[model samples]
Target: MTDHNTAEWWRQAAVYQIYPRSFADANGDGIGDIPGIVSRADYLAELGIDAVWLSPFYPSALADGGYDVADYRDVDPRLGTLEDFDRMVAALHARGIRVVVDIVPNHTSDQHAWFQEALAAGRGSAARDRYIFREGTGPDGSLPPSDWVSTFGGAAWERVADGQWYFHHFAVEQPDLNWSNPEVREDFLTTLRFWSDRGVDGFRIDVAHMLTKDFPDPLPSRAELDAMPQDGAHPLLDRDDVHEVYAEWRAVFNSYDPPRTAVAEAWVRTPERRAKYASAESLGQAFNFDLLEADFDAEAFRHIIADNLAQAAATGSSTTWVLSNHDVTRHATRYGLPPLNGRAEKQGAAWVRAGGPEDQLDRETGLRRARAATMLLLGLPGSTYLYQGEELGLHEVADIAADERQDPAFFRGGEYDGLGRDGCRVPLPWSASGESFGFGAGRSHLPQPAWFADAAVEVQAADPSSTLSLYRRALGLRRRLQTDEGLEWVDTGRSDVLRFRRPNGWEVITNFGTSEHEIGEEANRIVLGELRDGRLPGENTVWLALRA
Candidate 1:
């Protein structure tokens, strides 16, 4: 943890991330792009987000759905042009919103220029130093230095046509970059400067934890990591001397003004380590997988929050909590259903490409829960990341066929757990008008989700009771509150009910529990909006100001 005494304002801000492929397609090419996102900035500002984070627009093989970077500086032609991004950035800035972009430094596409250089150099070459290589024989004579498995499954090492193995923690096509190399560091820093100069407010550093693995050697088996212990680093993660690499990047990010830097991803595995990374001194912020990993235990959640706050105190660092993002099963599918046979088995309307629609979760129940969830997201401690369409309570889409799926995770792990991301990545619904498929007439990059026809934004805008209206109101309330200056940084009272009382005298209270419960030690003052008894209507909450 660095110094919160002088932390940047973005530290107190909330951000929204848009997966471009699914945001809205203007060209009708079945893909969402910069222009499409620019069109929605007006609506986004209505949500009162501090900034916008557009997933990578870099040119790529689309190997890992854009994580595989073939080129860093250029936008994918399919998405749009460099000018389109310039306009999008300008438009958001015009609205007083800050911005961040994804930077996958841990690795690059195998087709990346650096990787190509390494491939040609083979072993005992300068470029080869940019990646890990081991000399050994395997049972099959075609295996990794050891039996390490990639996050996507199978061996971590992939054989090149030259009979050499390159390591990839994820999909083989997405080769992991070696941070230990000075040249690699220089190149990435230059890239950072390139964008920061372009006015990007910050970055959501992808795989920040894995930026450096001190020594490249054979790793323990998955069984070993899973069996040994959860206390230390999960052997699969936590390589030695990682701090040096982060320190380097931290130094670089610090050199900029307003810092224009935000680091978020699933990197920290333990509280002590999480604190070290999120420490104001190390990296800007880290995405809390703790919240996403929580099973439906209110006590567990209470414990997680308690520990996170305590850790923040321990390191004088910042802590963040998130419900869902582009990578996971949408929150509706994960938390909306009642515990059936010990888990929420009902597929919260997950998309199944060409597999037809799912009616298990209806509009009223789903939308209400969505409203309730968004309320929690905004009211939670620390900064928030709002996934696109979540404001309207979108559900998991149909499971696209394996052949049509683009996510490498789906392709690597086979069926079942490998469900394609199409459900969560489908096009956004923007209007009820005929032929207005989300972002007007442009070629769609992917098939439109079924809700686009009637459940569009225009239809919801006219109805005060619509979820869109709920979102606007929520954002308005968020904008109106301003007591952050006086609140205790690590308050843990009202455990089951996450509570934050701002110096502005406004109390942001949420009921993450299943049943209703009354808060406040005394009679409530004028309710900001309608109230349902002392409790909100099902896991809901209200924003209030105390009256003396």
Candidate 2:
């Protein structure tokens, strides 16, 4: 457990992300709820994470997988109630684990009371002014207001029956809020205070870079956007004005006794731009996703690490490292598959939809590389964010039937583009023999593949060589080995291997190539991987203690 009194505890914390719906189900409803999280509090504590970052458990109509929040202050009835949320927070705190909840500030569900009122209040009404509403382009106003497109696909604007078009960066069910509206800004401040008062340790701001937009009278077409310089400010993303919103949010966060912390889910292009969200006046941390998008190559990982370190130093903030999340394919599966040829964002959706050819994936090699990659991730300086089930080496459930797909991206022409994220959101397998593999008494909302039986928590728990055991040992060792805020690169004289030394005299060496590498260090203990004939095996990571 981390010392809460320590300043910026999150800087060194190991945060675990729990996707609420698939984490665990306590009520046998097939959907994970707050009580389910409470039930797993001991498990989380045993996993040795400092905090659990819960994805949106708020009231929703299942639009955009709860990103389209209908209400910010309460839990969905299907998931749990306010009392249950309180209980969940208390339970984790009792185990010395912090609670970080997700906050979707960019947009709100159309089902929200405010949006409902906006629809009824007619065009140009005060309620309508709370969201982005514009007139159509054509004479009869048949076309949309702009040529902008949603991140999920299709036109960003949705025309209402009243002949006015409202913008949604995502699905039509999620309407973008107008940050220029004082009411919209103040209401979000209230929402922050509501959760802060309930004792949440921090927040993970959803689409943090997208709160403010700078749409011209006639928005540039998609082709023009493609031709624009990479450094140019996006019309709807990472605009300069978004920082002002975070400034206000920072004030609210600072008003609390412990001063709640936040991490921005900003997807800006450069490390410098991303660091702005982690400046002193903004959110204290921002996810460095370059690692998630990189190949398993050693040079790629080295470059990303150096860049992230420089960015963090510039902002005086810690880097947040994550390999897999609910939005992408599990690293285990990705490592097993062939190179994506620059289609990393798709996560092999097209290949998976085609039944995942055996020749395309080397499962054993993938798991080995995934383990090595995690070792590299944990050994790095700064905070580490672990997605749920990565500890058990879970793979993407790619063969989910098309008829059962629920991700809004799948329905909005994203399937053809191989953009659906459902494969990574399958429920976890706890037991090997249960009807739903211990997810719940009922069937899971997304179908679980049969291979999950081999990866069940029970089975992994009993196997010492399993990925679960590796994670436990690695996490336990990390708590002791992580003594400095930076690392010194150790030259291995080989391009295929990476070696870095922590200030405390602990060295992390990983062999990324097929050839075995010699262990040149005289260490007191081998913390993680093993050595064959005093040589580190290919695709293996070893941690060594070189000092007292």
Candidate 3:
């Protein structure tokens, strides 16, 4: 096991993200609970990750996949009680793995006590002041407050029975909290301390850039919502006032002995705007999604890496890199399709449906690029987040039936196609054959594809060259490198090749072209993953150890 001695541990940590409902099922029920996570502590420790960032397990109605939080203090009964959460944290800590919990401060479930109180107390009450409530437009208060669109889809504003329209950037069930309210700020600070005092190492702030909004009028037009100014001039998102909220949160974080940290899940207009979340006075780190959104081109990867690193440097904070998360399509299936064509985000359900036929997914080709991309990502200079089952090379279950879909965005967004995040959040296959593939005693919540048995942990653990083994080896090797230091780009003189040298004579080279490149004997190297008779194959990455 790795030592947890460094105070700046997060800067170089390899964090594994666990979707609570799908990681493991200890009980006979189909859902994965905190005890299920406790039972799998050894597996995570063996995987060589320094921390585990669990998705929200707070009390919720399961709208927006548990993102619509009802209570931040207690755990959901289906997942387990608050005591079970404490035990889970202790078990992971005993195994040298830190715990980072999801904090959904941007919004709350419609059933949350505050929201319900607001609804029952009617308009012009103090309970209504904690959230963004606005008077509807038009003669009879029938129209929405503004023309802003929800990120999920449709109108961003949802009207209540009290003749007031509430704002929600995501699903209608999630009412956006008003950060301008002192009571709301104080309540969240209390929540932060409540969890930190319970021994959580850090937090993953959801929708970190969108806590504040410009209300009443003069909102951004539909055209303007497509792109905001780089200097944080957006009318509704990444506004100058949002950082004040984070700064207050930073104060709460610093009150603890170890000084807890946070990572922002903000998707801003530009790298400069995104970097503000991780500035010296704000969150410890913000996800650099530009790397995840880039295509499979060598130049695209290099440019994204360079730009992200520069932005993080400007903020005096470490960069965070992630490939697959709960929100977007998994990289395994995404890489198999055509190049992204400069698309920087997941294009919604209808777009995925119109992309192609499901039978044409090049699984083998996708797995190869996924492995190569992982090697390249791990070799970079920052903290890395690995979504659960990414090591298993699990493809997206694209054919989920319409009735089985659960994402609020899929149903509320008015999409006819059954496209939703349920595809990537399918219950994992542990054994090759079993009821639910050993996920639980009952059938999985989302149907696992017939091919999942091939990618099961039991099938891959025994194979030395499997994707799971490669990740184990790569993570183990990554721990030994001077990863937190700066990287020097190597001029390979080929647009399709990316070569960068780390501080400790560790060089990473990836070939995006469809040709093999032979390495000379002068650079006696110990290859990490890709080694084909001293030649690096296309769509493959190799880590080399140069002689000092």
The Cα error of candidate 1 at residue 296, in Å, is 5.5
Error of 2 at 311 (Å): 0.9
Tens digits of per-residue lDDT for model 3, 234-308: 666788788888999999888877789799998787777777788758887998876566667888888888887
RMSD of each: 4.5, 2.3, 2.5
How high is the lDDT of residue 215 in model 2?
A: 70
In terms of lDDT, the poorest run of 10 residues in model 1 is: 347-356
Model 2, 1-548: lDDT tens digits are 33444647889889999999999998998898889889888888888888999999999999889898999999999999999999999999999899999999999999999999999999889999889999888889889876777877799899887989999988999999999899999999999999999999999999898888777867788788657654536777788788888999999999987889999999888877888899989998999887765668999989989988989999999898998898877788778877655665555455433224446778888889999999988998889999999999987777877899988877786433453788888899999978789988889888998899999988998999999888988888888777768789999999999999888777899999999998845534676789987899999999987654
Task: List pairs with backbone clashes in candidate 3.
Answer: none
| Candidate 2 residue spans exceeding 4 A from truth | 1-5, 229-233, 341-359, 414-416, 520-524
Best by lDDT: 2
Tens digit of per-residue lDDT, candidate 1, span 1-548: 21222336565466788998778776666677788888888888877777788788899898877889988888999889888888888999898788799998888998888889988888778987887755545765565566767877688888876667777888888888777689988887788888888888788888766766533345566576557543334444554355566677777788886665666574555776666667666665776777665544446655776677676567655566666677766666655444323434333222211112354544455455555555655654466677887776666665456567677666666222437565677667787553535564753555565566566787878888766777778766666563352343224354556655656666655556666656544327534434555554446656676675
Summing lDDT over every window of 10 consecutive residues in candidate 2, give the lowest-scoring window.
348-357
Q: Score each candidate by Cα lDDT.
A: 0.67, 0.86, 0.83
Clashing pairs in 2: none
TM-score of 3: 0.94
